[model samples]
Target: GEREQVDFRTSHRRKDGTSYPVEVHLQYLQGENRRVFLAIVLDLTERVATERELQEAQRTLSTLLTNLPGMVYRCQNDQNWTMEFVSPSCQNLTGFSHEQFVETRQISYGETVMLQEDRQRVWQNVQEALKNRQPFQLSYRIRTAEGAVKWVWEQGCGIFSATGEVVRIEGYVVDITQQRALEDQLRKTERLAELGTLASGMAHEIGTPMNVILGRAELLMRKAPDERTRRGLETIVTQVERITKIMNQLLSFARKRPAERQGVNLEVVMLDVLDVLQERLGKQQIEVVKTVSPQLPKVWADPDHMNQVFLNLILNACQAMSDGGTLSLALHPIDDTVELIVQDSGSGIPEEQLSKIFDPFFSTKAVGEGTGLGLTVVHGILQEHQGAIRVTSVPGQGATFIVSLPIYSEEVRHEA
Candidate 1:
């Protein structure tokens, strides 16, 4: 059978023996004298090349978005900020799959991930930025699907139509939790350095007077014949001695000596400190519990500094338990570092006071009973040795302090 018209696509060969794609069309034309067929060929080389280039660009874009360190999202300007498209990094950034974010199956980015207190602030900020047609940057905390809190930094702008109407919001979000922590630590270190300078100056100014008062009080006690007068002199001597002790602590805070670093056996140092406190522990009826891991590695630290560190901590534990309690101590290796855990079963610190415990002149003891520099000095010493200490406690339960120091290594020698 003959068809009125025929159309098909095929490859055409040139005289150079090179082939390119072509679209072919055939039409039949009949005349009274003769019958003839007409054919037309269209070259598709440019069209085919352009299609391939477009596909490659799309692939490149997809790869770049997938490997970004943070999530890339385009969402509606609605209350939930309902996502229209989200990058695969959503799992790592928000702990949710991209599919879930796109579908919003059971979670909404604004409602579920963002903190309740921050929801309104974020909404208002975005709206303000959109109103002005400008990009906005935000730093806020979000609770992840795992129930862990994290800090995030986001920068975004609105998608506007040709008529200048807002259509969508697109942004990138990255984790800043670690960066925020480092900044906070830097601030604390700066504050302590300033306070230490002030304390040192005051200590020097008061040191001579304090010593003179102690000497006068002792001389007066020796000269007094009446029992009441002698008792009064004794009280003066004791009070002067206490002030002297505080002055020495202030000087220590001001003049933190560089550590004489060496490989130290921390267990031996801890045991020696405990032995020195044994009598005090006995008097207070405080039971001691010790757990030391066998074959523990040595730590790169100063032996004397380690001794002072243990002494201050253990003595503090003893003071907390006036009615007698348990003092649990443990030592073990954690990865490349050694950890010492000190826990006390005494009148534990209040929750609100935990953060301030390491601050200078911050203490839980009654007036005239403490100088409040014990933990502050300990914190300074640990920082010098490239170590860290953290405390956990519940009011009336107990307090546990965890200290970590780097394990002895050849690199530590050069670094120290």
Candidate 2:
């Protein structure tokens, strides 16, 4: 019994007939005239159970991050905002792997990920929030890996030590690009409605004076006694007609066009617009590229309104390019909507003016070049058809306008 000592774990049965895991230490010693044995037992059930629970929790968190629609990140508050930890979904958000940002000194969050124009503002807001111990929330755009622009929302807070020193920050970044775009479209529609109301009142006020001018000009033309006077009167008549046409366009922009809800082919509408622009294109040496997918589903819109949408956009694209350039028209289906993408190789719009392009009476053209209502009319028509439009451009490179309309479904066809 004095030979050795052994230590191991086993399930032990208690006097109450309950068993649990245990670690056992047993030893035997030889005294002067007698042998002694000793044993020590330690319970391992609680410790093993705790470890299992911890592992389960870790697995659950991992599952959540994998399926999360957004990215969860933790990073330093340094100049580059060096990332510390990032979830796997970060790839979908930034097109970079988690390892790419974690402890990355080469390209931290701000310099490489955020848009250059928005960096300073983002820094300011985040710093202000950090100093005030409040969460920072910002909506900004990022340049995607594919060179497309994306709008993202970031909400984060500073991690502080016990001494009130901020050493790191953590946050969630979600791709709110689509949501932000829809908000912008809603705001523009609201503004268009407001402008329409104002235009209706103004049109009423302008119609009477316009009629007086037309009547007086006609009377003067009929009574012209000399060739010079006749030419002057005839010029007045032509100018009056031009003014009337301008007024009609304003009214068209102001009044809502009722949707006929027919199965409308936007590609055919685009072809018609191209047909009308054929002569102008020839004069300007402009080439047209049409990439409309054949047999696409029709949209629930009025054909006339659809034609107006395409015509205005096409004419605008044509006018923007003073010299010969490529004009591209592309059509495709996006989920439940049809998207018509029109692009031009003309001088693109300035960034500052992008937000105001759809505004009423806004134009970048020279005097007598445009009535400044073409785009407004286009926007109004799209709104009437429950459609949407968005534009992207880089100054001097060119512009692309995307128009999306609800696709007509079989249910609607049967109803019609």
Candidate 3:
């Protein structure tokens, strides 16, 4: 009889009476009358231990991959850069499944994914690093499957052969969109700080003269000899006042004044804003539609600053619908904040210009028509109140500005 199949693992006693793993193979020998059976017991301890270690290592590696904040990949160096191995996180990094890249030739990692402006530069950087046998570090943008642009930071090195030829490339890539945004914000903050200093100095230098001129004009109006003279003096005072208002906004934004906190009802504030804009709304044929929830909690903010915020937003709405439209003001409470929406049915803001809307001196109005600081003032005031503002718009449909303010609490201070 020949050896039959090995039965699986089993325990076998050693010569010293110690038990160890073994696999048994049995052979049956045909004998005269009686059968002789031969059994071969192969040691399984090493194999079993090795397998256990392998499974444990696999579990550890899986956990590591799962917890990684980005995608890990191995790819070829040739054109199209065929992917040989891709981690599960690739889907989040590229909006494409890891399976899509594994052994796929349908797309090049650069031409298809990396932004057109960044593709060539990325390839050059990676290849140069590989040529020098150094790891490459790159930051670039990728167009997602949903037509979104995202920034990514990648670090990789080439795996080479004994002959100094590149065998493969391995790397980890992570989404850095939020990081880039934060960096941009920091840069903006720095710029605003510088601008604030300059504005503070200029506000003092010019403020005195502006006040003197307005005061002199008012005095002249009081002593005007005729109606025509009085009317002319009144016009001068009005223009001076307008200039003063602009300066005040500039100074306020430049100074970053701390808010004087009070419990403010957004509904009341919005109604006051609308009351001030009633004449303008009627002249422009703009209808006001307010939807404030009755149970909405009051927010902790400066009454004056909050009034300014509402005024600016309402005025913005009126300007947007110059040819008659609807202004919708909606307020609701969410979690610890009050969400207020001011939507306008007018020509919407362009996507490209939306980001700049809150920058100082950024305006959509004609020259001499606006200081371009309207929304910037609104933004500054909101920030002082420990609030946030977001805007949404379509090309021709309209624009919506959402304001989120923290609800009032004894623990929440004005400086928050």
Candidate 4:
């Protein structure tokens, strides 16, 4: 008999009654007067155990990648950053499934999520890092699937071949938008604190001279002989008063007076402020629309500061609409906070200028029309009260300002 060789894997029992993995091979041969079969058994116990260990390691790696807080990615060094592998966390980070990046290839990470303006910088940094044989870390902005922009931090290194050419890159990316915002807020707070110290010194030096000039102008106005002379003195008085007003504003900004916190009804405060501006609103032909939640809880705030806050906001709204537009005010309780919204149908702020609006001495008003510290003071007041203010605007349409303050509570009052 003559037969082809055969090989198969199985287990065999040992003399000690234990089984071990083995690979068996068989071959048949024909002798002149007899048929003979030859068999070979190869021990595979160590090999099988090694394979099981490798499988377990792969499973552990898979679990780690799946539960990672950020995205783990391996991509080629191409313009589109074509991803070869992406962890399941890709969906959590970029709002795109891993298959979209790796399998379908429908979305390229660089072309899809990364901002166009940042791509060049990211590429440059990564190349420089690779050249130096070092890891790269980058902080850049990305637009998410929901059209929201987020700040992300990535740390990775190039996977280089033996010939020193980068074949691919692997990295982990996590969202850092909140961290970036906190950093910006911190910088602004530091700047404001420094300005406050400087303002305090300048106000003291300028206040005395300003008051003297104002008093002198008033005295001279009383002694003017003719209409023209009287008019000249009047102008001096007006100019001096304006300087005094600016100095007063600087002092107010510099002051760090403790808040006289109380349970203040914002609806009542709004009414009072509106009443004060009634004549001016009428003169400008601006309409008022007010909405207040019927059972709104009082806010924990300083009454005087609240009055000032409302006054400044309403006046700003009034000033924004020179031709008389609608001023809409809304107040409601949101969770543990009370929210106030003041909207104006007027000349809105330019997108670029919105960030600078709260900066001291930055204003949109014409010369001599505004002291430029109104919004700064308002911002400071809100920060002191542990509240927040945010604004949104479209150039030709209108602007909306939202203010949120903590709701009044007996514990908060006692702590205050």
Q: Model 2, 1-416: lDDT tens per residue?
A: 35779998899899999999999999888877998788999999999899899999999999999788888988888757688888999778878777778744455677888899998888899999999999989898887656667899889999999999998999998999889878987887787677667778888688788888889988988898898998998888787777876777777857664667788888788788888888999999889998877779899988888888888898899889888899999999999899999999999999989888988778978787777888888887887677899999998999999999989988765755
Query: Which tens-of-lDDT digit does each residue in 134-177 have in candidate 4?
Result: 99999998888788889999999999899999999999999998
lDDT, candidate 1, 233-296, per-residue tens: 9999889888887776667667767788889999999999989998999999999999999998
Q: TM-score for each prediction?
A: 0.81, 0.73, 0.80, 0.87
lDDT of each: 0.89, 0.85, 0.84, 0.90
Best by TM-score: 4
User: Which prediction has the highest lDDT against the true structure?
Assistant: 4
Better of 1 and 2 by TM-score: 1
In Å, residue 218's CA in model 2 sits off its true spot by 4.2
Candidate 3 global lDDT: 0.84
* lDDT of residue 244 for candidate 4: 80
Which scores higher on lDDT, 3 or 4?
A: 4
State in Å the error of residue 6, model 2.
Answer: 5.5
User: Distance from true position, residue 17, model 2, in Å?
Assistant: 3.9
Q: Which residue pairs show backbone clashes in model 1?
A: none
